[model samples]
Target: MKTAARKTRPAFLDAKRGVGNWAEATEWLRDRGIEDIECITPDLSGVPRGKMMPSSKFTSNTSLALPSAVFRQTISGEYPEETGDFRYDPLDGDLKLVPDLSTLSAVPWESDPTAQVICDIHNTKGEPVVYTPRNVLKRVMQLYTDNGWRPVVAPEIEFYLVAQHEDPDYPLKPPRGRSGRTITGGQSYSIAGVNEFDELVDDIYDFSEKQGLEIDTLIHEEGPAQLEINLRHGDPVELADQVFMFKRTLREAALKHGIYATFMAKPMQDAAGSAMHIHQSVVDARTGKNVFSNPDGTPSEAFFHFIGGMQQLIPKALVMMAPYVNSYRRLAPGMACPVNNAWGYDNRTTAFRIPNSDSAARRVENRLPSSDANPYLALAASLGCGWLGMTNKIAPGEPSYKTVNEGTTIDLPRGLLEAVSLLESEPDFARIFGQEFIHTYAGVKRGEFETFMRVISPWEREFLLLNV
Candidate 1:
């Protein structure tokens, strides 16, 4: 294969293996009148867990250490006895929090002059924690780098703005618009719907600019009070970082406006599901040219194999794409969400969608992921699936254009238990992600499932309890 001309590596990636310039970062925050620092690292559940430190304590070589057990904790903060091996084996050990300096930015929404940075977890020996979602993604990127390929990804994440609810058991409603009336009607792509929240949109733009997140377009989705925002395409690592930070920023911005923003995959039973649809393309490491297209402007072999590889892995990789029990609810038979791995031209029915575009812009849109999945893990799984095909020259045959066509026989995992069972044992998946990560991630997932099953749902009481 002829390599593309050499392109410069993104600065953020260069620092992934090394610490960011902390000396200048400290002085930069001080110059901006930042007083406090929120140091955060993403846990297995994609939840941020860390401490807030005084700006005075911020140093060039600051080390934030915490127990490794935090990574094994379930979504509800419980540690399953089975998964607790990482919790307290002869007393829980510390993992060092190494901040990625490229992520440092001022927290614009906060009343206090504060800054925040995302960190990656490392063992006491300063080894990358393979189980950490961020580190896992980093390792996956290394696979592409080793092959002299770079992936460009842009994400369109959907979320909802709902009324504040103090109780978990209660259903959330759409918050009132500026007109004081709740946005109950499904106004998909309505400019009027967006105008109702101009203040919020403006605030989001201002906050994002201050935080270094390049947010692109905003749209009113099919669901009531739902907003879908697009991010500009760039390096996969930085794109993942932006998505993670953007989710938090939306919540903080919503709270300031007296509403709650949620990224739950299926927040409402009747509402359309929220998805984190990733648009991806590979570029030659040297030339920075799109690998999906040939010099003559035709579909390249890499493009075909990428789709073939994605189809091969979608069944097992769905767990990473849609990481929760609730996520399955979104993948219905006939809904907009994909339940099969079929690939087609601009088809929304398939998991792999090739949107109609020019040769230079040709890319695959993996629509399997929910808004709830961790960006780092989801992106890694997505790229790895395609990379597998590219390297092996996997051939995905004809595209389906009708219902009940090809790929219908391939039964996708319908629940979290089934997904995890597949993820734990899938050989190719473990190869792309490590065996250690598979074991650790599977343990955490099973713990969450077991805890979830213990709950008696409203449907159970409504049907099973009375009927029985």
Candidate 2:
């Protein structure tokens, strides 16, 4: 009897030798005395979505399943269908989440020896959820990989530490610093300002170490109680994961110190807004050479084209970079934010900044993304736009020394409404970033804008309540 050939054990199912083996992760966790794990995924707004489970389950065949509608969840706990005539089914069907074994690490602040693992979403048919922010990033990264190149990124995120505000009506205020005094004025780059919050800063460093986050520097920003933390440069995906956890880590550390850590792009109108500036460069995978620079230590055509691509796409992709109504507040004139969608060497006035660096380290610093924007989506859009430039060979003209004063054709969008309108009309944007994603993103943001418009703000009550 010619029996069916015996099925050979594939390396994946074999578990003893595979890239995505969970058994190895479980063994590593047990060696470290971890008893539980927090499975997490960053949603559209960058908020973490997932649950905790016993670490022992990592070795089991079971996977985490969550409703597909979770992706459509608004910041206000409502769905798009409830507020609009969108055609998406918005079903309650479950999508399986596969844990990334590489992300398994211990949670420092937890009472239990709990670890954390970031996950990728997959549908019932075992296909990746292309619209998931992380998956979208992976898809764009694939483009680089296909071209024998890899992207490196470093994220410098600025944020605020404020006293808890119990009432939503009151504006957030800076908490008393470690010197037992509140910051009543700006303290940009003041060592004394950093010293005022020594304990909190120490906790940030300590927690960062425990979590394996390579946060190299902390400096006082222009705003009172504002600080910028820089994560060491590395792979784009790895850096995005670290930034995602770093925000939560800082928040937990802040709460333990009786302060609230906020990444809200514009927590206070009078204070300088927070920005998560991402520095990026591409390197040849085989030779480890920077594609952005020529052999003689000069910027290459690829570099200029990359910048050109970003300039054309930044306005169209502003919705992804800013992502919130308050985000536009930070992008105004005189805020030291953006003026024209111009490129310049070592100039912060332009949205795309080419920081002064040697040939090997030549990179572009995207200064537009707010602290509130999703790291994965932001990187995808930024990198994706650059890819479009490289492939299409877009030309970036002369660097404008003075962005605001420079008579340039760059038409910067002033609000979320305008940004969304611009986004909807971009032909190449929907083509590369996926039409479904662009539609979903713009639609959701539109819903948010409508909801925001319906609200009566304090300014309205104070100014137009009786006069109008």
Each candidate: what lDDT?
Answer: 0.85, 0.84
Residue 351 error, candidate 1, Å: 1.1
Cα-based RMSD of the predictions, in order?
6.8, 6.4
Model 2: per-residue Cα lDDT at residue 91: 68
Could you tell me which residue pairs clash in candidate 2?
none
Model 1 off-target regions past 4 Å? 1-20, 83-89, 403-410
lDDT of 1 by residue, 156-264 (tens): 9999999999987788899999999999757989999998899999999888887888989999999989999999999998899899889988999999999999999
Residue pair clashes in candidate 1: 4-286, 4-287, 5-286, 5-287, 6-286
